[model samples]
Target: MSLDYEEFNALFTQFERTAIHLEMRDSYGTAIELPHMAKWATGEPDDLAWLQDWCDLVREGTQAGKSFRRAHVIGEPLSDYQRWSHSIMQPHIDAGSEVRWVPRRLVSSIAFPGNDFWLFDDRLVVFHNYAGNGQIIDFVTSTEPADLRLCKAAFDAVWPLGIPHEQYKLD
Candidate 1:
């Protein structure tokens, strides 16, 4: 079912005790807080250490069998995407967690077909669509898987086509 903006915000605010899966397109920001942790993910640059800390929390949660997944699509060729995504994801990769990146085409094929994209957690799944006047309509669901596997598949397919971050020397 669909939820209005306020209802969606309330549901997200109350979702601290369960696993969450997120499918994000375009760009946005989210503030996530767990028992002893809190984090912010956006298109902007965040402290690397802070992201590492969250990765650790997620790892601990995983060990105890808590489900958590985040899938992001790179819509721009901006360095910020690479930097932030890599920083937030490096720790998980180091610990052998499955982190995936999907391209726009694949994501569009699987998504609900709109502009603002989707966000899914254990409490609710939000389909955010722009109303053409800076307003948004959120379609929420409580049963979506966050679909990280499909996103991963798409990433695996696209990663090889892009330049490795290490080799990219931006002036």
Candidate 2:
């Protein structure tokens, strides 16, 4: 089924064991991040206030024995948005989310599902759809056997191939 933004964020607070997110896009058209993105363009250290809620959720979940992992598959010559996202992702990592970077070229052999997804506890899968220009479109959540298998297989194939956040450098 489809989920609105609030419903999407609510999953973080409810998953029983793990939250695995696979991000395939380099940019997100976010109004909430506009000022921060602009500041980043000028080489400023963007404020962390905007991210507090998510970070808190991650921190609390992890502290409660949940594992939160995110793998980002990005292309060469990172876009400005990628750089911004990389910088911002650290806070989530610090809050106990295991984040990794996988350069896209090396993973061509594996089949991708075209959209980004969040797999919760190996059960529910939420696919994130976006416009060509990076605008948020909608999210589809699934618990079908076939979909879970595909998502789990795809994620397992890519997760180990990713470099830890600290070791990955955008170039």
Candidate 3:
């Protein structure tokens, strides 16, 4: 089912054990992110003060014994957005979310879900639908056993292949 923003954000706080995100896109055009990305492109420094909300959520979740992990299946010679994302990742890492990067070529053998997603506790999945221009269209959530299995398996298969954020370098 499709989820509104509030409903989607609620899942982040409500998950009991873990939250796993698998990002397959090399770029995104999130409206809120454009300004930050533009600053990066111009070589301007970012205080990253805007990320406080998410950092706080991750900090609280980890302190509560919940785990958050994200794996990005990215191509070599990263897109501008991904490069900027990597440069500004220290705060999220410091906030307790474990982020990793997987080279796309290494995952050619494993099948992946059609869209990027977050799997909460290996049970619920929130798929992010995007337009061709990388603008988010909507979020779709699923609780079907098949979907759960697919997402869980996909993430598991990708996780071990990822290079930790600190070690990953732009190509």
TM-score of each: 0.44, 0.95, 0.98
Measured on C-alpha atoms, candidate 1 has an lDDT of: 0.45
Per-residue alpha-carbon lDDT of candidate 3 for residues 105-146, written as tens digits (9 for 90 to 100): 999999899999999998899999999998999999999999
Which 10 consecutive positions of candidate 2 have the poorest summed lDDT? 26-35
Write down the TM-score for model 2: 0.95
Tens-digit lDDT string for candidate 2 (1-171): 999999999898889999898998878887677789889899888678889988898899989999999999988788888888888887998899999889999799998787899999999999998888788889999999988888888889999999999999866
- Which structure among the candidates has the greatest TM-score? 3
Two-way lDDT contest, 2 vs 3, winner: 3
Clashing pairs in 2: none
**What is candidate 3's local distance difference test score?**
0.95
lDDT of 3 at 3: 95
Per-residue lDDT of candidate 1, residues 1-67 (tens digit): 7777667545533445443333344433333322112233334444555456556766666666554
Give Cα-based local distance difference scores for all models: 0.45, 0.89, 0.95
